[model samples]
Target chain A: MAITFPVEASHILMFARAVGDPNPVYNPASAPGGVIAPPTFGQAVAQFDPEYHLRPKPGQPWFGSGKTPSGVDKAPSAGGLHAEQHFEYLRPLRPGDVLTVEIKPGATWEKESKRAGKLTFRERIAEYRDQTGELVLIARGVGVTTERPVDQG
Target chain B: MALSASRIKPGDTHSETVVSNLTRTQIVQYAGASGDYNPIHTDEVYTTKAAGYPSVFAHGMLTMGLTGKMLTNYVGDGRLLKFGVRFTNQVWPGDTLVATATVTEVADLVVKLDVVTTNQDGKDVVRGSAEARIDP
Candidate 1:
């Protein structure tokens, strides 16, 4: 699926406050311009609306059956864990700067396990770029979809 | 609190830090603030019976927040560049966890550290690595 989302400054401030990140860049009082979003604020970019945010739709491949309106949940396994996360910051996020988050399946590895019995593990990689088309940050996240019992030996 | 990188030694050990007890309120707050609403963290029965856990547990990221406190309190603010951790063991309520970090590698611009947190029973609850950038 191809879509674009315009990230607003308010969304960044709300997320930073919620996570207890006291960085001045993220605080309105500290930033005369606007709040500076936290490093993890890139994760919120995945929820942007296509029509309202993107330039155009270039029909892309649809992989999963279920999809969250935020476009983050595309797997049938309603369950997901932040198994691992890594971020590289290129520049700080400023207020009133809209962003585009291009998401795609990074890697899909299926394994045969006595416990998991044989399920697919998917890693969704999302990259965020500011309105100026400069890379802001990259977020790589892994989600596990298993049909086996939570307790299987 | 400011952490002095110069005072840290390869073998220097920190006094054990006890979390005292984990509370449901803490988990709920973490869920709301962190945007992680995984049911296992909030649903006790589901976690206990379905997830094969002893009880409802804390978010790995929430525990990471505690670990971040351990680092920023040691290495000073605005110095950490890249910090990462893997969830090896699960932490539960009433389990007091201790965090410790040791300098593994040092340089003019970067220093590497190995960090860990364990329960009173000596069971390792979390293990990870952190890095900080030092002034030249």
Candidate 2:
């Protein structure tokens, strides 16, 4: 899937705050070339993905609770877990740089764990390109679905 | 300011307390900012009763984001060439996280680092490597 991500200074500020980074570089006026988005800021592209399952969309039945413990009668035993994340940056992303993100399935594998039972790992690769079609960042993420909730002990 | 190759070498390490007494509200803040609204990270009721967890936990991306801050602070803004991590453990509320980056190599005007983030118990929560541009 592909989504358009318009990087904005306000959004960068908010993200910086959320991550507790008070660096002056994230502020446009404080930085010479303009605010540079944080290295992991590319993950924010999820906000633009209309079909992202983690986000609840209007008119759709969300698995999250509303009136009951769960909105769905049969909610999965547990949600998928993020196993790994990697990023390669060709250049810094600045405010006003509109990027087109293309995500593709990379690999799939399985493993057995005593803590979580069977783990099905799925890898996703995302390419972020500027409006001019220049590749700015490449992100690879791995998600795992566990047969049961991880043993906290 | 960017790090200079001449000023750094293998074995050099930088560490910072990335987050102190992590809060659920801050987790929600990350979810809102990152647009990842997974109930396992926010809705305690759903996570405890429906999902079968002690409580809601922080998003893995949130921990990555927090760790990135320490990296950028050490390497300088906009200097990262690569960053990656594997989620080793779940981060929960009230946990204090400390991130550390150790220089593993420095050459060709670039520095490679081994990064790790640990919770109050000193248990590793995220571990990986990063490369950043450096000045001669």
Which structure among the candidates has the greatest DockQ?
Answer: 2
Model 2 / residue A148 / CA error / Å: 0.2
**A-chain TM-score in candidate 2?**
0.95
DockQ of 2: 0.91
Worst 10 residues of 1 chain B by lDDT: B45-54
TM-score of chain A of each: 0.65, 0.95
Name the runs in model 2 displaced over 4 angstroms. none
Q: DockQ for each of the predicted structures, in order?
A: 0.17, 0.91
Model 2 lDDT tens row, B10-77: 99999999999999999999998999999999999899999999999999999999999999999998
Q: Please give the clash total of every predicted structure, in order.
A: 2, 0
* lDDT tens readout by residue for model 2, A19-129: 999898787657676789998999999999988888998888888889997899899897799999999999999898999999999999999999999999999999999
Provide TM-scores for the models. 0.65, 0.98
lDDT of 1 by residue, B44-93 (tens): 65555445455677776666665655665566554566666665566666
